[model samples]
Target: MSEPAVSVARYLATTTAEGPGLRTAIWVQGCSIRCAGCFNPHLFPTEGGVRWSPADLAARVLAEPSTGLTLLGGEPFEQAEALAEVARQVRAGGRSVLTFSGFTHAALRRAAAAGRPGVAGLLAATDLLIAGPFRRDRLDHERPWVGSTNQEFVVLDDRFPDLADWRPGALDRVQVDVDRAGTVSVNGWLDTDRLDALLADL
Candidate 1:
C-alpha cells in the first residue's frame, strides 16, 4: 500500500532549523493573511504543490532516521486535506507531525467554531501547531520555532484539550523586512502565480 499524499512547494529531505533531529520538511503553497509586510512573499500566492502520494513522503520519512514530518508553507492550514493526508501517513508509520501556520491559535479556533474551510481536520491531526504571522520588527533570532515574538509555538498533546475548538476572535498579522546596506525595508506577500512562474522558469 502507498503511504499518503501532501501538498507542498517543496519537500526538503532535512532542515537544520525546524525542530528536532532528522526532520523531513514539507513547504506548502499559498497564503491569505498578507500582512502589510512579510518575508517569503515569494511563496504567498502559490497553492497545491507537486503531487506526491502518502507512500511517497512516508517512505522518505520512514527510510530516514527521522521521527516525523515537519511542515511549513505559505500556509499549511489552507491546504487542510493534503496536510491531514500527510499526517495520516506519518502517524500510520509511527511518526509524528509538526505543522506551522499563519493563523494564531485563537484565530484558528474561531474559524473552526464558525465551520471555516480546513481548520478542523488539519488541527485534529497536527501534533504541534506554531501559530501567528511573522513580524519583521518583532523578529527574534533567539526564538527557535517562530519568526517573531507575536507568533507562538502551541504544544497540543492531550493537554488543554479542545484548544483548537475554542475561539473568540482572529489574531493580528505582523511585518517582515529585508536589510539592504544597513537599511531595513519591508516586502509584503508575493503573488502565487508570479512565484510559481519564477520557480518553474528556474
Candidate 2:
C-alpha cells in the first residue's frame, strides 16, 4: 500500500525565524478558520497544492541539518494524519517538532480525549505547539514564533528546555525570500501597520 500524502502549499528548507534554531518549515494548504487579516490568505482554499508523501517530505526535511521541524498551515491540525507521519519520521531522526495551529490546546486535548483520528497522534508527535486563531487586532510582533497576543506557546515535551529562559521583545524577526521565479514570500510576525506598509510596497 502507498503511504498517505499531505497537501503542501509550500516549504522552506531552512529558516531561523520560524523557531528557536534553523528549522525546516512546511506550510500545509487548507484552513477552515478564515481569520480576518490572516497573513497567508492565499492558503485558505482547500484545493490547489501539490500532494507529497509523508516519507518523501520527511526525507527532504532531514536532508538539511536542522535543529527541528516547524509545521504551519492553512491549518496543520486539518491534515493531522499525514503531518503526524512526517513528525514521526523526523523525530525518529532526532529532530524536535514544533507545530502552529488555529485551534486552542484545550480544544485539541478534547479532540484527543474523544478519540478523534489523527488528533492524538499529531499532538503526541509535537514537542511544542503554538495555538490560537490569528487575531489581526491583537497582532503582536514582540513575542517569538507567534502572530498575535491571543496565541500561546504550549510545551508538549521537554526537548527544548531553554525555551523557558527566552524573553520577548526581539525586533529582529521575519524573513523575506525571493525564489528563482522571483516570487516573494515573507515569514514570521509583523505588526499590523508594518505589515500593511510592507504589503502596500509589494
Candidate 3:
C-alpha cells in the first residue's frame, strides 16, 4: 500500500512564534470548519498544497533544528492519521508536539471514543492542544497564541514541564519572512489594526 500523504500548505523550519519553544510549524491544507475572519482562508480548500508521504514528512520535520513541532491548519484534525505519524516520529526524537484545531476538545474526545482512525493517536502524540473555532467577536487580547477567548489550551503531558502552570501573560510574537523571490509570508497572532500597519510599513 502507498504511504499516507499529508497536504501541507506551509512549513516553517524553526520559529519561536508558533509554540512554547523554537519549533517547526506545519500548516496542513483543508479545513472543514472554515471560521469567519480566519487568518488563512487560502488554506481552507482541500485541494492544492504539496503532498508528502508520512515518513518523508516526518523525516523533513525531524531534520529541522527545533525543540518542538506545531501543527497548524487548515485544521490539523482534518488530516489526523498522517500527521499523527508525523507527530509521533517527532516526539520519538525527543521533541514536543503542539496542535491547533477548530474542533472542540469534547468533540475530539467523542470521536476518539468512537474509534476514529487517527483522532486518538493524534491526541496522544500531542503535548499541548489548543482547541475551539475562532470567534471574531470574541477577540482575545489577553492570550498569547490564541485569537479568541473561547479557545482552550490543554496540556496533555509532563513533557512541557515549564507549562504546567502556564498562563496567558506571555506576549504573542508575529514573524514576517521575505524569501529571495520577494514573496512575503506572515505567521503567528496579530490583531487586524496592528497587522495592517505592520504590513503597510513593510
Candidate 4:
C-alpha cells in the first residue's frame, strides 16, 4: 500500500487577539494532551473540522494586503506535514507565517531530536512562533497573543529570537453570547469541556 495519506484537520479561518497585523488564521484540529483548562477542547474532537488544501489556504491568505498567516489549534505543530506546506507557501510568496501551539519550544526541540518530521522545515520558514499552552494560573491580560503569562509570542528569526516588541498590546480577546440556538461565534480558544458543563448546567 502507498504511505498512509496524511490528513490535517482545518478549522474555520479566524482572527487573533494579539499577534502581528491582519492575519489569516487557520485553527487546525486534533490533540491528545488534554490539558485540564484547555481553551479549545472542541478541537480535540477532530471529526468536526474540514480539510483545506494548502493552495486554497494560501490563496485566501494572499488575497489581503499587509496580512500574514497565523496557525492555531487543535495544535498546528501536531501535524508537521500540514504546517510545513503552509510554511513553504508563505515563504515562497514572501509573506510570514505565525503559529500558536500547546507545545513548548523545548518540547518541539525534543520532538525534533526524536526524529519528528517537519519541525525543522516549519520552524525554518516561520517568522514567529507562540510556544507553550495557556495556563489558567498564569493568565495575564496585558500580553501579546497570549492568554496566560506562560505562553510567549516568539519571533523565530535566527538573528533575533530574544527580542520582544514591547509594543502596545492589541485588543484581540473577545466575549461571546451563545444563544439557545447554539450559535458559537467567538474568539480565542474555547475550553470545550468547561463550556459543555456550563451549557449543561444551564
Ranking by TM-score: 3, 2, 4, 1
Residue-wise lDDT of candidate 1 within 39-113, one digit each (tens)? 556668765567666566667677776666777777877767666766777777776678888889998888888
lDDT of 4 at 17: 43
lDDT of every model, 2 decimals:
0.64, 0.86, 0.90, 0.65
lDDT, candidate 2, 1-202, per-residue tens:
6666899998888888887878999999999999998878899998998999999999999998887999998999999988999999999999999999999999999998998878999999999898999997776656777878899888888877644333654343678787799888888767767767887787
Q: Which residue ranges in model 2 land beyond 4 Å of their true spot?
A: 163-166, 169-172, 196-202
lDDT of the structure predicted as candidate 4:
0.65
TM-score of each: 0.69, 0.91, 0.96, 0.75
Most accurate candidate by lDDT? 3
Query: How much is the lDDT of residue 143 in candidate 4?
Result: 60
| TM-score between candidate 3 and the true structure | 0.96
Using TM-score, give the best candidate's number.
3
Whole-model lDDT for model 1 versus the true structure?
Answer: 0.64
lDDT-best of 2 and 4: 2
Lowest summed lDDT window (length 10), candidate 3: 162-171
Q: Sort by lDDT, best first.
A: 3, 2, 4, 1
Assess the local accuracy of residue 18 in candidate 3 as a C-alpha lDDT between 0 and 100: 88
**TM-score of candidate 4 versus the correct structure, residues matched by position:** 0.75
